[model samples]
Target: MTTDLVAAVDIGGTKIAGALVDGTGDLLHRVQLPTPAGESADRVMAALTEVLGGLTRHASWSRVAAVGIGSAGPVDARTGTVSPVNIPGWRDFPLVEGVRATTGELPVTLVGDGAAIAAGEHWRGAARGRSDVLCMVVSTGVGGGLITDGRLRPGPTGNAGHIGHISVDFNGDLCPCGGRGCVERIASGTNIARYALAAGWRPADPEGDTTAAGVAVAARDGHPLALEAFDRSARALAAGIAATATLIEIETVVIGGGVSQSGEVLFAPLRRALREYATLPFVRDLEVVPAQLGTDAGLVGAAAACWSDPGTFLAVGAAGN
Candidate 1:
């Protein structure tokens, strides 16, 4: 029997990746290009076009039944528009229309990267077989998606599970999203490094590294300030996770991205802090695990968004809340 396929696009500030994905969530033909984030919107579109162009050249393209897009957001799935903060050139950009135009008007599904990640995990990764989950990526920025009752809930605006911007410290620091003490402000890799540096945690080597990975190494080596930074980030993340569980009763949270690669450094403190914050009986059993799909999650999930049963993609009525 011939395998069916979907064309998937994962778009972010730094890169545009496209793939032809099979029904089993496997990528067949993949292509990538750097995103000209600082350039004009047309330039970014051109890059996306190039990615789509490459995918269409593959022989498997003949089997592609639909096109799916997972974009750095805030995207309005309702209107097929996107406004990613990192990609300033795409404020309310017509991403769905653009992709449709690129692929001969094939049916296209657009979702936030976070939502896409959640769908990927639910379909084939750590959250597989689960009915309730929260999937997150904690790298340059923090992003998240939700699975409620086994369905991918994109909400009205396609940003339903945006745990990053949710305020954990209302009076703390101001977030770029105009919120104070957002989870992203305190828990992202960028914030982890910033906090460690500001707390007098200098890199081991003067000319070495100063990124979050550097801080993780320092923390493992017993740097007090570096350890403190990770602890703080873990605490903030725990609070956000607990809040989400409190609201919707998720069973597990799968974390991905560069910062999550810190492994025990991040998870140990996170589990400890979760014990303190997730005290409710119903939420106490929630599990926090590492994501299994890694970087391919966005693409796979984008394809899943197109291929999963229609009932699984139904929007939750109050998802926007």
Candidate 2:
């Protein structure tokens, strides 16, 4: 008997990853390629094709029942399109149509990367068993998704819980997304490093690495400026999380992405700041936890989307042609 499977695709700014996932969320086969982000839209599509083609060539491809995609925002599940910020070539690109054209007859499900993360966590990660939760990824940019009443809420455009663009401080700083003092402006890895650099925190590495990872090391070693940068980021994250919890009454906030890996340097101050912001009675029990799945969360979440609703976004008959 053939084992049931789903083709999961995770499209980010840096890479486009694909995998054949089993019902139990185990990846049976995987393929990945760099996302030609600076190239034309067609070039990006070619990269996606390469990844999907590799997955279809696997021995287990015959068992694949559907395809699911977790793409960078803002994705319009209703319109089967995507407009990722980092991938400038794709502005309302026909992603679902392109996937359907490539795979021929398999149904496709589309959701923003953040929504996908939330779905993955709700199914098997830190948000497991929780009905109301918020999942965030604080890397180059801050992205988030909401799970309300035990259901993933991707919103009409698949960009529902976009906490990154939500302004935590109306007058703090102008965000590229045309918002003032957005959470991402303060808490994202890029911003963290930028703030540290501006505050006189120099990297100790001979190569002069200024990434958030470098700053994390400096913070660990008790660098005052680096620690202060993280503290500022944590405070911003706390404000954003608190606002989300207060508005939606979420019980948990699961954070992933590179910056979240800083552990105590970020979470310790985040918890303290959360206390100052989330003062509502309904939000007092909120908890913040690290994401259980690592980089594989997006892939697993994409597969979970297929397993949950095979034809939610694309027609089932559009695959395998």
Candidate 3:
């Protein structure tokens, strides 16, 4: 008997990564493709087809049972349509069905990128064997997903994990969502750079937008402006976390993504801010840690979604069957 394998795809603004993942979450085969910029949905799908075609030719066809996709924001897992803000021309595109058309009737699963990360962590990373966990990706934006009572909440339309939209300050900066001060508007990678720019923090990468990672590096090197920038980001993130903890009381908050790679530069200040602001004693002790899977998380989580039955998560799938 052949072991069942799942093809997992992680689609981001910069690139698309795919892997053949086994039941144990081991990557058997991997492929990377540059995501076309400013292209129509058809062109982007063509790029994906090229990569998938190559991967399928190399791997055993009999063992591949499913295809799983983890895509950026505004994706509906049930419908498998993607409408990422960063990726132009992908408004409600039939991403899962498009990929499935190439897979010869194999089962295809779709999930929010942030939710996929949370599931990936629970499967093999920081949140493994943990039920109540809030996984956050503080990279290009501060996105998050929730796992509560040993169940992953995809919510209606699978858009439940838009933690970035959570408001931190009622009268603060106006968000793109037309709200006052959303967590993303203040603490996300894009907004962090925006704050740095407003504060006149110049960088050697003049043409490039000064990112959160750049600010963290500058702070590490004792740049006062960068230090101030991180301080402000930390405050906003901490306040958001505190509010989330008050509501959910999760056991841990796992932080990942590009900006989170700053290590102590981001975590230390985040913890300090969290401790200072978190009013509840229970919320203060909520462990904030780095994600273990690193870059492979999105793929792994997508695979996990496939392993889960339709409209169900891993735990429920396992028990029901």
Report lDDT per candidate. 0.89, 0.87, 0.79
For residues 235-315, write the lDDT of model 2, one tens digit per residue: 999999999988888999999999999899898989999999999899887899999998999998887765534224332
Per-residue lDDT of candidate 1, residues 1-321 (tens digit) = 353788899999889999998878889999999999988888999999999999988877777777888999999887888898999899989887777767985677888999999989988999899999999999989999999988788776778899999999989988889989999999999999999999999997998679999999999998999999999999999999999999999989999999999999999999999999999999999999999999999999998877547423322221211
Off by over 4 Å in 2: 1-3, 309-321
Q: lDDT of candidate 3 vs native?
A: 0.79
lDDT of 1: 0.89
lDDT of model 1, residue 38: 88
Q: What TM-score does structure 1 among the candidates reach?
A: 0.95
Q: Write the per-residue lDDT of candidate 3 for residues 1-321, one digit (tens) a residue.
A: 574787888888878888888888888888899988478889888888876776687647568777777788788765668898877878988887788767776767677888788878888889888878889999878888778876566555555567788988998889887888999998888877778878888776777437777787788888888888778888888888888788888878899988889888778889999888786778878889898999899988878767554333232111111
Total colliding residue pairs, candidate 2: 8
lDDT at residue 103 of model 2 (Cα atoms):
81
Each candidate's TM vs. the true structure? 0.95, 0.94, 0.90
Model 2: lDDT of residue 144: 91
On lDDT, the candidate that comes out on top is 1
Which 10 residues in a row give candidate 3 its minimum summed lDDT? Answer: 312-321
